[model samples]
Target: MRLTPFRAFDWNLRSCGLHGHVTYRPDEEPLAERLHTSTPVGEAWRCLRCGTFALGAPAAAGPADEAPLVLRGRALRDAVILRLLAAERGIRGLLLLLLAYGIYRFDGSRQALRKTLDDYLPLLKPAAMKAGVDLEHAGPVRLIEHALTLKHSTLLLVSAGVLAYGILQLTEAVGLWLMKRWGEYVAVVGTSIFVPLEVYELVEGFTWLKVGALVVNLAAVVYLVWSKRLFGIRGGHAAFEAERHAESLLAVEHAAALA
Candidate 1:
């Protein structure tokens, strides 16, 4: 018996079963020759996606310039990148929402938290003194004390702002993950707007994590603007659509026919 080696996942075939094979009939001679052949039962057209021979007349017959069954080559690569960005946006959004919720909850129960801290501080402080740690001026304790002093209205505003930022992140995530034109616009514009803020934060205190985030956002903005032709850059929407049309499987077959 012969064994077959493992094959890399084929995105083309992933949807073929559910959507049915995409078979097209090109009336032109050389293109049709490349795409279809006669079988014992009938003429079998090649599926544009999986490249399987399906017995029957083509699902649609005409020129070979029809839309593709699935994204291929550079289009597929672009899709992967978009989804990776989307995932990052999604995670950041969730974390921000949780942070906002934590602040809100802290505002409500701060007194209780302080009482608990006071109750435990005598025991903790003795250990801290032995360990050369200052319980009164420790970073976490200081932050909690400062937060306890904030006005209710101020806490409310801060929570609301964080929640709004979180929602924006989630919205961008959905758009990018769907690979919509509007989503690309949202990501580019949103990231661009916040980039200055990120820079300001980095300037205040540098951290590799912040630097990484700044770089990623900058790269995403550049990619969406230039590669996706957002705004009027790179010839705008018409050129973007034309590129997709040109990158279709049928377009390649058409070029092959000419060759």
Candidate 2:
């Protein structure tokens, strides 16, 4: 038989033990070959190249590798569904921001807003006092309300922006969870766009908790985009194609076996 490099085959040696050595030779050649094959106690084969019996007996026949049947079915379907869910979440986040903006525009009372300056006023008081706002006459609540109302439009815009960002984050998270390679790319690009802004915010204000939150978000974005291999657009497509081919091969094999 013609010897091919890197070719794998199953050889059956009747008398060889698990660690027996066997010789392989061209059907028409005078050269003797030795190789080792491994096998369980009763079924062993030897490699013709080496006299060592470490090589195990080869099976009569088998496929090179078994495709993961379950992953192709339930796992892949689940990934698709998750991708849809992620997209929906992003849309929802966008709607929330829009609703916040609507509330800012329609509701004159600052307290009426769902997420308002009133909520963040407590956190800002210490800063305002440090910035030389008189606490005696200007109570924290009053001061914050006045500032918020003064910049009502700006605050609304900021809220809308944050909502939009949240939506984007949701999209990326969902995409990653679902294994859509494009989701990963989009997530990385989108999140990276915000990194500088987040850094600026942290530097300007220097709130411990907010800074921590920014750092965590940044780290997550980097991990998903780089190390996870989800953002490799070409690689992802290739993986999908390979999965499809494996599925097709499995189907064909099953059909043949049934036939």
lDDT string for model 1 (110-223, tens) is 889989988998889989999999999998998888988999999999999999999999999999999999999989988999999999999999999999999999999998
Write one digit per residue (lDDT tens) for candidate 2, span 15-96: 2343343322222211111222234554333232222334344322223123222233344445555555466556756677
The lowest-lDDT stretch of 10 consecutive residues in candidate 1 is 250-259
Q: Give the Cα-based TM-score of candidate 1 against the true structure.
A: 0.81
TM-score of each: 0.81, 0.41
Best by TM-score: 1
RMSD of each: 4.6, 15.5
Q: What residue runs in model 2 are displaced by over 4 Å at the alpha carbon?
A: 1-106, 111-143, 151-156, 228-259
